[model samples]
Structures are given as structure tokens and as C-alpha cells.
Target: MSDASRSGVTPRRPPPMAPMGKARYRVMMTLVALGLALLAGRIVDLHVFDRSFLQGQGDARTLRTDTIPAHRGMITDRHGEPLAISTPVVTLWANPQDLPEDDIQRLMLANALGQELDALNERIARYAEREFMYLQRRMTPEAAQQVLDLRIPGVHAREEYKRYYPAGEVTAQLLGVTNIDDQGQEGLELAYQPYLAGVPGKRRVLKDRRGRLVRDLAMLQEAQPGGDLTLALDQRLQYMAYRELKAAVTENDADGGIVVMLDARSGEVLAMANQPSYNPNNRAGLDPQGLRNRAIVDVYEPGSVMKPLAMAAMLETGDLPLDTVVDTSPGWMVIDRFTIKDIRNYGKLTLAGILEKSSNIGMSKLALRLDDPVVPAKYRALGLGQSPGTGFPGESTGSIPAPVRWSSSQWAALSYGYGLSVSALQLASAYTAIANEGRRLPPSLLKLGQSPAGEQVIDPDVARRILGMMDQVVEPGTGARRALVPGYRVAGKTGTVRKTDAGGYQEKAYRGLFVGIAPVSNPRIVTVVMIDHPRGDSYYGGAVAAPVFSRVAGNALRLLDVPPDARDPES
Candidate 1:
């Protein structure tokens, strides 16, 4: 101001303003141009180079790829009866993060899912970080729809299939049961899982904020439905066997029972039933013991039922004939501190008489005469000590001790159906060799288009003679009298095996068994019955198991319309 006042008339006035300096103006324009260039590069990079990445991030929020479930195959009996079927079901799931926090909505969702509100809240809290969680699996379609109608956020339903068994408990152990994911858990279902479980397909879809599928994005893959399975079981015969086995178990006050019926000509398992069986349709209260297929899996000392097999093996050596007599006087013999006895001494007994009396002494004598490895070899040839090759899960290869190291006492025990074990299926299949006239066919649970090739295990003539000897078991005063059918020529053996406990054989604990072939003239079927721990005075095979065989086989034969082979005296 002093300089201006001195230069001009006013001291506050300053020199006149001049144009902006070139350098300063250039600096300002350069900064503005740099900012614009940076902005333009950023716009190009976002719209071009990183475009797909950003799109993926955005799609991840609302788009989902789902699984398209394939239906499982149907399991049918020989007559086309549905043993197992698959029905459409739905699974409810949710995302905890997307679920509403409102208490009322949460309560409604919990009720729909059959869960308590507190439990649901706790589950949600526990899975708070998870994007998906199962609410209910395998719910009925209507129930799942009820859940979806509520339209709670983050809740969803997925289509699936559930297995249903039409035969219920009758075929429970045979057909087995599946899991909530339609995977086989046991029985034939597990054995054939590869064929029964189809490959699941995939799909891509868009979902809304509430987790509902809004549109089909793309078809990722096509689901392949499983193939069907036809078993050799006859539904009618299965029902009958179940009924008879259950009745016998109840009547004898026994712990459990099993019955297996096979087509003698084909080795087809026409009927197999076990008591303490569960309902495949409802597995809520299933006991592990009840899930066992006893006929195919349970092993036991077969008692006198093995006598015939021993006789057949000895006869094969040409050293013993059907009618060869053995002196059984005094009824009992002792070997190596083990006493082998008969009910009574019949001075001398032919092979047939030994079987008829269920004579342990006579059979033991016969077994002792055989050389080592003879008995076990014959048993192996008859499908004992090996799996039946039916592809059944947990199929047992019954124990048969090698004869190489066996003592005379052990051999004798083997003769009278001890010192070894045999499943009901193995015993029945062994008898089928006799019924099939020496041709032993491997057992099959699946229906066969033709009779399978069989191994010739015994002489046809020897088998016929054994059949005749077995027929004598059903005659009056024989051990298996109760196994007689009024109008059929029945051939069978009776067994009363002492159960082995921790120390040794328990006298009162016995397994009664009967293995028979009906219409012995031609031998159409082989039926085997085993009753476990019969608790009454009459625990013999003839009294407990033979009656079941009589009822089941007799009725089964008639139902199949096989003409009676025995002449009716009244007619």
C-alpha cells in the first residue's frame, strides 16, 4: 500500500495485474490431464479385461447348480410282484445365513420341519457359517409341499426317491433296505448296488433371494435310471414260508426259525423266510439281530441231518452199500473219552435203519471207517464249506475242519453232524444234490432263464438209494414221522443238534432241523426248516421243525399244482 501510494495517488493501490505465468498454467493443465487419463484407463479395464470375473462374482449370489436325481430300479419277484419299489420324495434344506431372524418365521419353519424351535435355533446357530444344511430328508411330497408353501427365506426342497418294500417283513431280509439317499444298506440291495443305483445327473439354475429355483439356466447332464432286478423268489411261497416259520417259532416258544425252499431241478431259491424279521418299509425300531438272513448266513451244527451226507460219501467209496448192516447192539460207544449213543440198540442196522433211528452210534461207526479227507472232500463237492455263489452279502461258507489232522473222535463227531457247521442254505443245497439225482446246482437268488449247468457230485444210483433211505425216516416209528405229507412221497432227515456254549455242548439247548424233498418219485423241491432253542419237552426235529416242513412243503407243492406222487389208499 505504501509503494502504490508513492507510485500513484493512493498508497493502498498495488501494481496492475499481468497475465498468468506460462509455467504455472502448464502445471495446472498437466495435473488435470493426468487425472482424466487415469480415469479413462480404469473405465476400459473394468468394462473389458475383468468383465467375466465380475459377472461370475455377481452370478454366484443368485445362481446355483443342482443335482438331478435318478430313480432306482424296481426289485420284483419271479411272478412280477414288486418286492421293492422307488417312490418320489423330497428333501428340505436351508441356508442359515439367508434365513430370516424373525422368531415367528423361525417357529413356523421349525414346526414344518418337525423340529423344536429351540433345536432349530441351536442348529442354525451351530451352522451359521454354512451355506447349506439339511432340514429333513426323504419327506413325503405333500409334506415337502407344505413346507415350501410357507416360502421362508433360504428354505428349499430337492427332489429325490425313497425305497418302499411291498412284501414288508416277509421279504425284509431278502430284499434289504436303502438309506435316505437311496443307497442300499444290506441284503440283495447291497449285493447289487452297482446295478441298482443309477448315476445322478447335474443341472444349472437361477435361484431367487428366498432360495427358490426361478429359471433353468442349462442342462448339465442327463440322469440315468437304474435297471430292474427280477429275483427267483415266489411271493406266494415266500408268504407261506414266512407264515409257517413264524407260527412254528411262536408255537414251540423258540427264539427264532428259518425255512428255505429251493427248486430241486434249478437250484432256485423259491422261498426263504426268517423269524425275528423286520419290516423293510419301516426301519425305525429295527434290531440288528432281526436284519440277518438266517437261512443264508446263520451257521449251526447240523446234528443227524448230516448223517445222510456221510452215508453218501461212504457209499461213494464202494465199501458200503445202501443195505450194509452195522452191529449197533448196546446202543452206544465211547471214543477218546467222548460217548456216542443211540436212543436204543436195534441189534443191527442197515444204512436206512441208521437214518431211520437217528442212530449216532451207527453213523459214527460208518464215519470212523472212512479214510482222512473223504468226508470233507465230499462236503465241498456238495457246496458245503464254500459260498453258494448267489452274490448275497455276508453269505457264509460254513466251517468244515480239514480231515488231515482230525482224530477218530472228531471224525465220529463229524459223522453225527458235529465238529462242523452248516448254514441252512448249504444243508438244503446239499439235499438238493440228492433230489436232483446227484447233479449239484449252485443256488441262485435271481431268476434264471434256463437251468444252470451243475456239477456231478454223486452217483445217480447212490442218490436214488439215499432218497429211498430218507423216505424210511418218515415211516411210522421213524424219527421224522411228523414230516410225512398225506399224499406226497417225502424223503428227509431229522436233526437235534446240541448247542455249544462257552465250555461245551449244552444238553437242553438244541437246534432242531429238518431237510426234505417232496414228491420223492421225481424230486421237485428241497425244503429245509431249522428251529433255534425250542424250549419245550418236544424239542426234537421231528416234533418242532418237521411239522413246519410238512405244512410249508405240503402246501407249497399243492400250490404249484404238482400231482401227488404217492397213491392215496382211500382213493
Candidate 2:
């Protein structure tokens, strides 16, 4: 061929090497080569595989993780009566960054989210750069549903529990309330949080397209409900006592009032009532003053009600005898720089006469003799300056200055209840030692498997001697004339102390206090009453607080079927 012709035809180069070309052979060889390739592919897929694409697509098919909320436990009283309960509350949450694309739904949601708009806006503005933020928490179920119906993307509802009070302010001082997050904040709820609150459980669940729970992945551990409480309280007695306490505060136009009832034999508190009280369910509306459980929270000079405790301490230490006598002037006496005065004085006062008259001068002198080195030891033995451990949190350790802290006026003032401060309940408990035949019982609000046999701090004989003097105050003296219970021998004392005002004492605003035991034969209850800042003309305990105690005790005794120590012949 000519060179030109060969170049033009271009060498056709042996079919440029078809890789394995129809296979050097037969149809069986070709099929066998295909089979081998298919097997190789299968082996690679089964062992040394890359499943990234498949896993990514599978994840999109369903959820990657599951989560579930734990159920809160219930709280009940000693008798199985529900005092505090946990109810489901729904809260709205959002991922504003992923706000729904639907304009109409957004508008509807914005409107349903009224009232909390400002707060919601603030929250959104803060996390404007973030992925998610809670819009509203502690929402009512109805409100949560309305928000959910908007069907906004990244917007959802979560369930939590809120505390509820069935008895409301009636049991507020003892039961206390929990915060919106179901955490204990005060009272028995706070003190016993560990046992009363349950451990949270975890659950994993798969959600559907609509965010509904479709599958439960796992339940890590079964949550245990909170154990129930058996209180020392009787509901009937609590209501009656609160009613009386409220009425006294209202009638006397006093700033506040407190009523505490203790079972005489057992030191268990049967009822604790404080007026100007707040509803735990509506804590948002409560005023700061209304939140105080005055019986155990506020400290005051217990006034003349402390006279008996002072005198008992005196006799217990042999500082004074029941028959001891002193010269008491008309109604006053002069001490060093501070002149001491009495409500009224007797010409010649016996030791018992000092108690009957509530003579400040007499108590002051008696206290002078009681200034033994053992005074501090005696006070400690009485449990002063220590918490009552009554299962009520934040109960103040009523102030009792150390011996080194007491100045010259302090010794005398301590006897008249000026230098020392004590909660109304503490004074009530001290009187309990006197009425209880000298055993200093520890006060308790919890239901005990057994009550400790209290230590005998005072001889029963000395205690009864003190009790007799106190009983006299009730019979022919200021207390009995006011705290009159028809059949019951109400042994108690009246107290009137000028309250400490701003920088100094308010001579006008007095704390009227009374503490007593009823049904002398088998003392069933110790009633303590205190009225703060009474504006009425009669502001003394004999006028304002004791009457309330009589009314409350009368009803409580009858309701508890303690057999009215005596029925009001007038009633």
C-alpha cells in the first residue's frame, strides 16, 4: 500500500485493548466472571462496608434519641388525708430560630401567648443568637394546648408538677408549699425534703412526625413514689383553731395573731395556726408579712407569760420558795437607773402572789436571786437557744443571750421577759414542762413511731407548785378572769410587752401573749396565743388574746371528745 494511503486509514490499533474482551471465550466463562465479581462485591458489603449513607437515611426515617419526664410523688398527712399534692402543669418551650414558616399560625400563637408577652419577648431577645429558649413555664394545661394547636415548628410543651394545698392557709405553717419546680421551699416540706421528695426516673421514647410518643425505647429504672406522712395533727382541731385565731386578729384589729395547740401528754403539736396567713397555692399574691408562721418564726419578749418559767427556774434552784414573801408597793419599784413597774401591786406579796399579780417588780427581784451560775445550765436544760426540731424549717432558735451577754438590766429584764426573746411556741413548750409534771418533752409535728420519754428537768412537786401559782393567775388573777373556760381549770398567765420599734421600743404597740393548759386532771392540750400590734383600747393578753384561746380550746376540747372539762353553763 502507498504510505499516504496507510496514514489516511490510520492503523486501527487492535481494538485498543477491550479490558477482558467478551472474555477470551465461551458464554459459561463470561457468566462465571460476572458471578465472581458479584460475590466479591457481596463480601466487601458484608464485612469491610461503608454504611454512612445508609445510616444517615435510616436516622431520617425515625428519631436518633428518646427522652421522657419523671412523675412526681404525692404528699399526704398522717391519717392518709391529702394535705399537699402534686399536679401536672404544662409549660411552653420554643426554638425561635426555627420559628414556623406559617404566618397565620405565628399570629395566633403570639396572641395566645398574651400576658407573658413581655417576658417571652425578653427571653426571645436574649437567645436571638441561640437555637432554643423557653417562652413560658408553669402554664395551665388549657394555655399549653392552645399554644400546641398553633403547630409551630420547634415549639412544644413539656409536663412538670406544681404543689397544691387542700387545706390552704389552715395548714400552711406546718405543711408549707413547694416552688413551681416541685422543690420543697419551707415548713415540713423543706425539713423532710430528702424522704418526702422522690428520686426522678428516666425513660427513653421514640416520637412520631407530629411529636407524639410512638415507642418506648427503655425505662431505666422504675420511679418510686414519695412515702406518705402521718402527722400528729387532727384536721378538725386545726380548722377550729385557725378560725378562732383569724377572728381574734380581725376583731382586735391586730397586725397578726398565732394559736398553737399541743397535746399535753405527748409533746406532739396538734394544731398550729397563724393569722394574716397566706395561701400556698397563690404565693404570688402573698405579702411578706403574711408568709410568717408566727408561732415558730417571730421572737418576742413573752411578757408576763414568762413569769412562771422564771419562778419555776427559781424554785427548781432553791432561789425562791412558793411561800417566800416580799414587800410590794402600790404598782412600781425603783431599780438602779431603770425604775421597774408592775401591772398592779399588792401590799405584801407572797411568792404565789407575785405570779397572781404578774408584778414586774416581784419577778425582777425573784430573778435577782436566780442569777446563780447554774442559770445558764438551767436554760440550756430547758432547750432554750436551740431549735425545737419540730420538723418545721426556719423556725427561729428563740433568742436567749449568753450569760456574758447579759448586762445589769438583762438579769431583771430576763425575769420580766425583756432581755430574752422566744417564739410563742417555745414559751408554750416551756409551760408544757410545768404542766407536764417537770418532764421537758421535745415538741414534734412529725408522727413518731414512739415518743421519747423526756428528761425530768424539774421535780414534779416543784412543777406542780409552779403550776398551782399559774392556775391561781387564771382563777382570781388577770389570766383566769379573761381566759375563762366553764368546766376547765385553765392554768395560764397573761403577757404584755412593748414591742421593739424602729431604733427603740414602741410603748404603744404591745405584744399580747397568753399560754395555758386546760383540763387540769388530764391535761390534753397546751394553748398559746399571741397578738401583735393591737390598736384596740384593750391590747393586753387578758383582753385580746386569751379570750380567743378560751373559744378555741372550748371548741377543740369538745371536737376532740376530751369531755369538756366543764360545759359553759351560759352556752
Reference-based TM-score of each model: 0.93, 0.84
Range of the 10 consecutive residues with the lowest summed lDDT in candidate 2: 64-73
TM value for model 1: 0.93
lDDT of model 2 at position 20: 66
Clashes of 1: 3
What TM-score does model 2 achieve against the real structure? 0.84
Worst 10 residues of 1 by lDDT: 10-19
* Alpha carbon deviation, residue 257, candidate 2 (Å): 1.8
Candidate 2 — which residues are off by over 4 angstroms?
Answer: 1-68, 110-129, 139-153, 208-214, 369-376, 405-409, 476-479, 566-571
How far is each candidate from the true structure, as Cα RMSD in Å?
Answer: 3.2, 5.7
lDDT per residue as tens, model 2, 1-571: 9896978865555557565655565677878999999999987785568566666665566553433334445555546677887777888877776666465665676788884545555666688788667777888898889888877777877777777889998988777777767777888788777776777666666665545556877777666666556787778888888998888888889998889888777787888888888888777767877777888888877778877777777787765655689777767766768878875667778988788778888877777765473444556677777787775767888777877756556788777677777786776677678878998778878666776688788779888887777777877445448787876777888888899956888768888888888877678888899988888778888889889888988887787787655545587
Backbone clash pairs for candidate 1 read 1-11, 5-10, 5-11
Please give, for residues 114-159, the per-residue lDDT of candidate 1 as tens digits: 8999999999999999889989999999999999999888988889
Clashes of each: 3, 4
